[model samples]
Target: MKGRFVTFEGIDGAGKSTHIGWYIERLRARGIDVVQTREPGGSALAEALRELLLAQRMPIETELLLMFAARRDHLERLIRPALAAGQWVICDRFTDSTYAYQGAGRGAPGERIAWLEAWVHGDLQPDRTYLFDLAPQLAAQRRAAVRTPDRFEREDTAFFERVRHGYQDRARADPSRFVVLDGEQAVSTLRVLLEEDIVTLCNT
Candidate 1:
């Protein structure tokens, strides 16, 4: 059987990360081979780029280019091979993040982002993307409670609001590929919903 690509997406502190491990365990219980990873940093070169991305403050164009550059390396070095080996791949973030963070949050041109996305990995897309939706102010509070903020995470609420809307718009445009979840929901509740979705995905 061919492997499925699953990705978790959301703005900082939207609680998507908390569910990935549990979701992987659930897949394992059913005997599925799974490879869990995250974007901006998956392969060695990608990881090095990730550090620069998270720390440096650069032009939106540079940031956008670097994002796709890391993605290309990640795909060539890790994501592609794992999927070819029939391992289900779960990534923390994907190109949708670029559309949200750079295209929307930073007011970068959408067409340019689309162009880069096509050039880098037009053939691949996550089979399912779980988007955790939340208000920017609430997400900001949650983020403040956690570890130090990264460059993107340090942006103001207005920026995050744009990012959130960007994610929602994409989800609306591609309903078949996105599953938007309320970030404020209880963990147990979200897991129950995710369990049903995963089972359905696995059976398909």
Candidate 2:
């Protein structure tokens, strides 16, 4: 049997990170062959690129190119192989983040992004993408109390708002592939909501 591909997405402070470990543990408890990973990393080369992406200021085009560069390596060298071996891949972020951060947040041309996506990865997408939706202002507040903001995290609220909408637009366009979750709920409640869909996905 083919393995499942699931990705988690949200704004920086939307609380999605709080539940990733729980999902991994719960999915493994259910006897699913689960694997946890993240992008713009998963492979060594991608990880290095991730550092550059998060640490430096670059043009939107440069950002887009670098993201895809890391992603190509991640998908080809890591994600695809894992799935081919029947390991369910749970990723922290995926291409959706590009559409949100670069395309929407940075004002990259949508057509260009679409073209690059097709050229770099043909018909490859997560089976289910969990989007934790929340207002960017609230997300920023949550993030402020945590570690220092990185380059992307340092963006203004307006930038994050666009990123948020970008995620929503993608979700709206592909309803079948997304599970939109409200992020205001308590961590435990969020996990319960996620586990139900996650287990159902594994069973199917």
Best by TM-score: 1
Per-residue alpha-carbon lDDT of candidate 1 for residues 53-127, written as tens digits (9 for 90 to 100): 999989989999999999999999999999999999999999999999999999999999999999999999999
Q: Candidate 1's C-alpha lDDT?
A: 0.94
Question: Which TM-score value belongs to model 2?
Answer: 0.97
Candidate 2's C-alpha runs over 4 A off are none
- After superposing candidate 1, which stretches have Cα over 4 Å from the reference? none
Against the correct fold, how does model 1 do in TM-score?
0.98
How well is each residue in 1-204 modelled by candidate 2, as lDDT tens digits? 788899999999897678888888887887878889998899999999999999988898999999999999999998999999999899999999999999999999999999999988876889999999999989999999987998989999999999999999999999999999999888888888897897678667
Pairs in steric clash, model 1: none
